[model samples]
Target: MTIETDRLRDLVAAELGRARDRTTLLTESVDEGDLIRQHSPLMSPLVWDLAHVGNQEELWLVRDVGGREPVRRDIDELYDAFKHPRRDRPQLPLLGPGEARRYVATVRDKALDVLSRSRLDGTPLVDQGFAFGMIVQHEQQHDETMLATHQLRTGAPVLEAPPPPAPAVPVTGEALIPAGPFTMGTSTEPWALDNERPAHQVIVPAFHIDRALVTNGQYAAFIDDGGYDDPRWWSEAGWAHRQSAGLVAPQHWSRDGDGWASTSFGRTQRIVADEPVVHVCFHEAAAYAAWAGKRLPTEAEWEKAARLDPATGRSRRFPWGDDPPAAEHANLGQRHLRPAPAGAYPMGVSPWGVHQLIGDVWEWTSTDFHGYPGFAPFPYREYSEVFFGPEYKVLRGGSFGTDRSACRGTFRNWDYPIRRQIFSGFRCARDA
Candidate 1:
């Protein structure tokens, strides 16, 4: 291996280790009952996630990349995510915590061995350690999902993190993004998934976007104004969904006397008025935007705000620059269980002065989830190709629970319009 290859190998191993550590932190504090219990029909059992992480690693790294026999072929079907729905996972014969830990540890040992001797070039899977990066990212994604499970579990607080730093100054009003064509996606980002592929030019008209995400105080105004009750502000579908679900405010939030409070990861606390509103679905975000006489930015507009630099006319890797996220730059990587106060992370602001565009909450965009022109799926179609359509809305940026490896300026997240289990929020956009 060359110097570059050696460095890549180390980075891949380190990321895998970090992901595993996060998974352990999320699951180890709970008893076996918690691990096996499915918190919601939308989410798998914690133990299923644990073993699925190992099963995916074994399939991709040990079986496919190394061309080795399957270590535990009998369990392969049991852990196939596509074959089994999350609702049925608890009934399956999932590996217990002890067995799951041992199994994954064994898989990791072999995967590292494969990494040690395997060439990091040729083919898309092996080229530039793509397979290794994929596995690391996959585990990190599942770690985020497991964290969500922890939040949905009805029990005492198991996860803990200090609150994020308060904003230095309050950010008010909006940023006017200049109208023109800017690169929307990435062709150079190594670990970028298929949906964010084939960087292309996107021409957006002049627009005004919120300087920061909508704060709890701001969202409170909407709730106080009866934003949910006013059907004029909601799309027909959104209104129907809201009515059926009986949603009055953001999920996990409740009216506490004269104020609002929220529960997260089994811990209940008063809502921080200055922090960005979270646990909101796309419908809620859209309705808030509509009530405020604004609209959700399109996926292209969101990307341009986060990536384009007007002076140089170039797309940056992040809002700040090509440098990776740091504690001072953005609130991410499970560093804080909740979002920082809006207007925080001035260091992470985009060239247009859009604050907290990279992290805090996954910002909802108006566009539906779809592929760019000339899109092609690599390795498998299930990852991105199959999910494209109107059913899912695009969400830009990452949340507090998102790992840096799984997030980027061009990274895309999607979910149903009414889903609010994830840490989702939005910044409004309007015509300039």
Candidate 2:
């Protein structure tokens, strides 16, 4: 179901407030020169990401079609996130930081009005709901990017203050859901993204999924048991990927005493075994599942189980009910700058009694990342076609470093098997 106008407006205001807090904190005590520096190969200059805080919201919700134009002509010349990925973003206009901030403020004003006044739920001004969803998700995404820029450029308060002394509670539960004639894609609803659409039907049989993600401890078991060395566990592609990565364990993990642990933000901590595994690629997930006699569920099966309508609620835009993410829901976001323990978000659980499905990490599906039967590539043809070769795999649900608005139960993303970073992770499933 779609969120109503008033509620959507309220959400917009709240998101703007959060964004302002982060932006203000990030920009304080910073030289203008540093804001323009590209911090990492994966990131953009702070100025571009800052402008996008307004650019993305306006692109779809205001300037594109949702509202009357706020800025004058040639907006794209000033801010177009699609023109380049963050790493190569063009410098912000030559205006002083104050004037630039004012320009950004105008864009936000336009977005606020559009989101507040537009009739979006049923007959959206734009034909596809994604146009709006993209804006929301983009803002949420910038919240994280803003934080990352602050951390990389300057040692900002990236971590939560009075941070919990204890680490995440390890996840440990498993559920074997009995599957049937389950709908595999979006339900009959107005405004679903095309990638999630043309609602189709599929049958999934009984299967078991870990109650939470495979934790650092569990993966450590795989390592102690020679999980990484055993080529038999790896898919042909997985083996090649691991060799290329030169990985013996998760990217950030380290051995602490007899057990394994991981570090983030320069803090060394013990690993939690009950949590789902993170920083793994499709190759590693596949290998681990094979070793454990489990398998990565197909997108259909994973979605089916997640759509299970237990007492908590119905199949929502997320495994949780139809609300945007919160810090308590999952280890999402820059709220904590690291993954919360898996299974921590029972409130966000799907009908299947799964935990942390929404936030901790994006789970890999067995299926290749392909278009649906009636899939039509809109907006840009190259987006879905250029990556259609045999190299990529589909990942569903959102990951920790993800934009909340861009993500949905049905949003699709993919990566080559060899890449690993803070954002990727996996869950395990098996045939019943």
lDDT of each: 0.91, 0.66
Distance from true location, Cα of 25 in model 1, Å:
0.9
- Candidate 2 local accuracy as lDDT? 0.66
lDDT, candidate 1, 1-432, per-residue tens: 599989988998899899989988887979999998998999999999999999999999999999888889999999998899989989898899999999999999999999998999989889888888889889989998988888888978888899899887678889999889999888888888889989999899999999989999999999999898999999999999999999999989988999888998777788888899999999999999999999999999999999998889999999999999999999999999999997779899999988999889999999999999878998799999899999999998999989999999999999999889998999999998
- Give per-residue CA lDDT, model 2, range 332-362, as digits (tens): 5445555566546666776667777776677
